[model samples]
Target: MSSRLSSRRTRAGAVLSAALVLGSMLVGTALSTQASAAPAPDVGIAATTFADEFNGPAGTPVDGSKWNHEIGDNVNNHERQYSTNRTSNASLDGQGNLVITARRENPGNYNCWYGRCEYTSARLNTIGKFSQTYGRFETRLKMSHGQGMWPAFWMMGTTGGTWPNNGEIDIMENVGFEPNTVHGTIHGPGYSGSGGIGAAYTGPRFADGFHTFTLDWSPNLLIWYVDGQEYQRRTPADLGGRTWVFNDRPFFIILNLAVGGYWPGDPNASTPFPNNLTVDYVRVTNTPGGGGGGGGQITGLAGKCVDVAGASNANGTPVQIYDCNGSNAQRWTRSGNQLQALGKCLDAAGGGTANGTLVQLWDCNGSGAQQWAISGANDIVNIQANKCLDVTGNNSANGTRLQIWECTGGANQKWNAAV
Candidate 1:
């Protein structure tokens, strides 16, 4: 979501329309509402890159070093709340939680798109303090609920580009009317605003208790999970040819409790005041072999290192396996989705998708051909070709050129990359 007037208003309208339709379909029906406790995070994914636990004295403001309070009326979403930096609007609960409260009174009589703001709330972001490209981002929180109430935990690209073009990933969003459901969405050029690609997860009322929301992002792929249960996955192929801008930049986190927005309309008489969106924690961890800007050797078949032939930066220079020599040619650095050695990407030759396509060094062009994913199984697969980086002819000899081939679970395709 953006801080200025943008396509999010359109996206909110779309969410409302869909909710209305679903509401009509379920008229007079009962939704099963239960309280669920947040699950423990998977023990295997223990590396932490960023985290905020919100532990502090009650009524204390958030750590300024970790979060920035965006104080203003959110005209972009046509929201009723005048967001403020006051502790009453957002504060630590002295119990390891950050509480963002939305109240009916606007002490400053803040003016909004609809004249005097009728409510007050808080919006916090990690824009300058932290940002990451590909990682496992997750939060544990309990939402606020009532008609016209909207709560979200999301991320926006950090490139300072325009909305949609910069990309937005909504890891968790809930409009009060849909008390038992939450949505995960992605917005980008050609498929943003109301046209965003997303999915919903229906479960016990989210406001009843804390739950875990997560997004696992990697080159050309995204997966969303609620309470550790996978619900949706998206890849470049799902975009129908639109640019997948997510893989090319880092994104920062946003958390807010909005009142009377386009999606939830206006708060009715039954809507409660002083409601809170309580966050237990927000954490981010690098996906193995996917962190950006660090150089390391990628060792593969017969313990040899992946190298650029002659340490050349020229495009089309062959990427080969050689004796384990600690040289720039053997040091690969991951930047976004592209793996680079000698300042050029490890690319599939000529954008080839066929078996035996020679792997070479090429300029980083933001093409799918330059994207790679080093899977948990140690197979470094080219995203565009869906093929594994292989040792040509299963040879571990010096100067053995690398190629893309069908993944055979063979030693030649397995790699131990320190990236």
Candidate 2:
């Protein structure tokens, strides 16, 4: 999700109240639990990879070093009440947490870079500085209540200016009534604001406490992770673009809890005041060898790529890597992405896969003999054999060693493809 999003005066307010009172009393149950009413995501897909762990700043909101404050309506969600700065807008707890509170105050009189002052909460971001290109990003947060409260955990491009054109990613977002469900969304060309790519997962009411929400981004895919499991995916195409915006330029993280909007409707009398968007932490990670030579800590179908201690990439004939298509030879099952290919993915040991050894694919019948894994940008090994898959005899013959051998860290171990 990229950059992103209210009403009127006394008489208009009265009319708004009367029409809404009848509307809510008529649809109170829907208003109270609006699960079915929430919109769906753009691609309705999920990722093929994710992070086993994370790395990021924690223990406190890093003040001017990591972020600057902003008022609402900068992205135009139709909010009348201004997002003013106060103890309410944003602050760090010193206990590895951040508090972004919204208030119904007299309009802020101090000069702000954006928005006319009014009653509301704060918006803080990691833009212009501290932005990242790709990594495993996550946050644990608890949102406030109000018919209008729209709390979110999202990202934007580093290029700055303009809304969805620059790209956006919503790792997690919550509307008031549906406090138990968190949303993951994306915004860019062909998808913006309420019209962007999005999805939701039901969980205990977030207002109860902190829960983890994540995004694992790579060159070809962006995955939405809810407590470690993948739920949604967006490729450059699903986002209707040429460049993978999330992959091209740097992106910054955004943490804010907004009050009512055209989408969340408006905050009502029963809505709570001074709700909090509590963040426990933010983490990130990186793959080695840039984008090539692999090694992003991915696992595959059970025994799909494993054959124990096989060679790295030293084999002479280039081994073809294919998308794990779930065919008998391709399916790799694992808790995360650690993989064991069927028949050593078949390369020669120590880069020797004997030219005439017969490289054939097999079913995932769960035999360690057929298990193999590629760890890091280098080292493609077979765990069961305790040897490297090498080019038979180191003879660069076109049809030579596609077999296994012991580790030597030779040329056969070097992989050619980018991750």
Candidate 3:
């Protein structure tokens, strides 16, 4: 969600600034749109961690335990709406749906970024109520329509960090101007705002009926689906050396109907008021392996373990392959895109990208040099460098230091990450 305030208009041929605000921090807002219409892959279900069916009597507010109303005019998005906590803006339809209405009236006569508020809507989030790291999050909903209307189902990291750096997953976002297109995007460091990596699925008008939007998230993969059809996927490799922050932390869900922002522009004379964003349900289920936050031995060439030299937590300590003695240094933990042992991250020395750059243990500073992805080919890849974690010289010596080298599909590059 480009929930940032910006006066720069880009609806024509101009460019939107990359310094738009999301929450209280600045971020970019350009989406690299990829189009796809593939069928959704068969996915197995697991234990559900969260679910909201939106069941209640008509006109009643949502369950307070499940959602928090984020009130106030969102100046960050340069929106014309004042998000209210009243049930009049958000209520159950008695038929198993939560409706968020955006009206032209502002009963409070609230002031906005552009003087008087022109609209009133509702924004709800599950920040403290629930959060998950890696899972399949899905929602079935019907979007609001008309120029200037923006409806979204998205997630934001709970790291309490600045925008983009904490990461964001846009499961579904629709602007009324393009009734048949919905976007799925990921915003993070070096790739926020107008530079966000995303894709658009264009088909039937989303505001005409209900559709299921989904995000299947794992350690290094995120796939988007609309109504059981796959549209786009993202991985660390797609970030172009940027930090992949999605795997390291838990994220909470957000639902809102925004009115008139940089992306959707202002409402037109023909635009409809009191448009509704109706949601039937939202659910989250655990994916296999559960993505990040796992710990175990990372075994590799000659059946040796990836070990931190001397089990030291000191920064810049060489990381090497050692005999499988089951020592603390051999115990590796996956935290987001990082591999840690003895409280230090496995890092590409000095953020190096050239082959032969030594691998070492460093302070976890959320750098791309410390980010790694274990691929399906059993290759442990350095995300920033796009290189494989190779055992130096293909030697299995107890003290053979590891290095980042071009992926050669050799046994020296293969790894069995128990993390």
Each prediction's number of clashing residue pairs: 0, 98, 14
Angstrom error of the Cα, residue 203, model 3: value is 1.0
lDDT of 3 at 312: 75
What tens-digit string does per-residue lDDT give for candidate 2 at 1-419? 22243111111100000111111111222111112221111111113222211122433334565566664443345543455556546666654457777776655453322345445676767656566777666665666766777888787776644555567788888878786787888776556755677788896777875566667677767776554345677776675544445666677777777666666766788976666777655544443121221122222222122222222222122232233332322222221112323211232213222222222222112234334555454554555555544444444433332344455555543333222
Per-residue alpha-carbon lDDT of model 1 for 1-419, expressed as tens digits? Answer: 43222445422101000111111111111111212312211112235688787878999999999888887776667788888899999999987789999999978878987898889999888878999998878777989999999999999887847777888999999988999999999998888767889999998899997777778788888877675455788999999999898886999898889998667778999899989999987877777332322347899888999988897776667788898877777767554455766545688776767766777877554466777877788888887777778787777788877877777777787799887
lDDT of 3 by residue, 1-419 (tens): 76434322211100011111113111122111112322222222226688887877999999989899987776566778888889889999987789999999978888876898888998899878989998778777888999999999998888947677778899999988999999999988878877889999998888877676778788888877665455688899999998999886999999999898888988999889878999987877665221232236888889999998887766667788998887777766554455666545688777777767778877554467876877777888887777788887777889887887777777787788876
Pitting candidate 2 against candidate 3, the one with the higher TM-score is 3
lDDT of 1: 0.76
Off by over 4 Å in 3: 3-45, 288-419
- All candidates' lDDT scores? 0.76, 0.49, 0.76
Worst 10 residues of 2 by lDDT: 12-21
- Which portions of model 1 show Cα errors greater than 4 Å? 1-6, 9-46, 288-419
What is the Cα root-mean-square deviation between model 2 and the actual structure?
19.3
Please report the TM-score between candidate 2 and the true structure: 0.53
Q: Rank the candidates by TM-score, best first.
A: 1, 3, 2
Candidate 1: the clashing residue pairs are none
What's the true lDDT of residue 221 in model 2? 78
